[model samples]
Target: MGWLAAGEGYEIALVDGKVAARSTSGRSAGKQLKTLPKALRDHPEVERLRRFADWLDRHAASCVAQVDAWMVSALPVPSAVLGEVWADEAWQAALRDLVVVGAVGEGPDATGFLRDVSEDGELRVVNLDGETVRMSAETVTFPHPVLLPDLAELRDFAVELGVAQKVEQIYRPTWDKPSDPNQRSSATSEFAGGRYPSRFALAARAESLGYRVSGGYAVHRIRSGGRMVEARVWIGEPHREDDSVTGGLSWSSGGRHLPLDKVDAVSWSEGMRMAAALYAGRTGER
Candidate 1:
């Protein structure tokens, strides 16, 4: 952004998302000041720039969050919608380089790393064949890492191309349920008995990691195979102040517990991922 005259002799502009000042008639005529001049601290231009910077920060975070939600649910988004938001810097930053799959006809799905969206709503992507392809499909999906059949190969190719995604997809950690019935259960105690200083601390950890705390349990809800399943870990009473210990992780749908064997691949991986993250923050183990 260009600098605007803030006071009699100073100009102000947003630099690195913060208001910065420069003298227009002194020894530092065109050089940015080490710090904002006191006289320009309350200038209208400076205040406006600060507010704009704040809005940009919020907008960027909101974009990332929305993209993350769509990826997690493997939701199919219209190609036109992508074109509509592509012009916005925040939206572009969030959506750029994400692995997208176009639902073309029955031949084979078009999969590639998203590169651009045209004004006419066509998507341009870099395919696995090291070629840029344009897709005009009605809808496209950001499939979950677990659902991508060529996830490992994609990761390798992404590295080769030096691709970096604002929202994690291909590189996100995942787990698979054991095929043996003997290893499957209604709940798993693998991450249980992790000790925290207090119930508040444990709950706070869950919330900080974007999980919900409900009825004394830390819960992660996932949509899998057209149904919603909740994976929860006991975090002790909400009103309790004493030390708390993490408990077993379990999955349920429609208020009925589901065995690990019945849990879908995405749900199982995400559940274990959440449990392990919470347990990693514990002060000790029981």
Candidate 2:
């Protein structure tokens, strides 16, 4: 699902899991309000709109996660698959600007923005020279960074042509799935901000960095000592928003807490990195 901004006189509306503003009669409410009138803001329809907006946001994140998974796995996505997904506006928007190297009969050659997929399943690519090249490959893989042999050259090419990928391309992180799920690790880390300006800012930053938001904590997966554990960073408490002190970062594997020192070097650094980003956004003194 996706969201489209309303034309006029509305906040938001629900459409096939997507959101738009409700176009209704009366004065087209355009002016910004510090606060909304209770009657309108608290209306049942308006509440539904709020819920839809939240769903739309989650859906967008999910899309990013799915694409990231494909890239990480270096999965061979069939041309048909791309065509089907392109039918959805949201998916198309997410994939439009990604770089692809089509697996032609000879080998992977045409590399550029996946401009279009024709009806007969032809991959239309705009090469570095800005020439359109049609390619036919039974399977097209969104190569992992390690697999992109010409990554440096491609980066230089993109820069020369002012080609900016809508989805992250230059620096997409990838990791092998945990090999041993039963491995034990008693690692922990802590993140504290003196205070925060707003919970929204903290949450948005965490989500942007691909952390899962839940129970007022920003949770991310990290591999520590051969174990995959979740690192949870606190956003704030129910009543803590106003004063907004941060201090609840923790690590757990199989529901067991691990001490910060026990965490592996990579995992420990990742946890602190997330914490530092949130802390830097605090409104009060660090």
The Cα RMSD of model 2 versus the native structure comes to: 9.2
lDDT of 2 by residue, 1-286 (tens): 3332433444554554533344344665543334444545556666767786687677776776677556544566787777777766656666765677666554444677677876556778767677778878767766555456666776777777676554666454422223343322211223475466667666777788778887678887764344677777878653344555556567777779876545554454456556666666677875
TM-score of 2: 0.52
lDDT of 1 by residue, 1-286 (tens): 7889888988888888888888899687999998997888887878888889999999999999899888888888999999999999899999999999988562343899999999778998889988888888888999889889999999999999999999989999888777876665533778888999999999999999999999989999998788899999999988898899999889999999997778898888899889889899999868
lDDT of each: 0.89, 0.62
Predicted structure with the largest lDDT when compared to the true one: 1
The pairs that clash in candidate 2 are 13-20, 187-258, 188-259, 188-260
RMSD in angstroms, all models? 1.9, 9.2
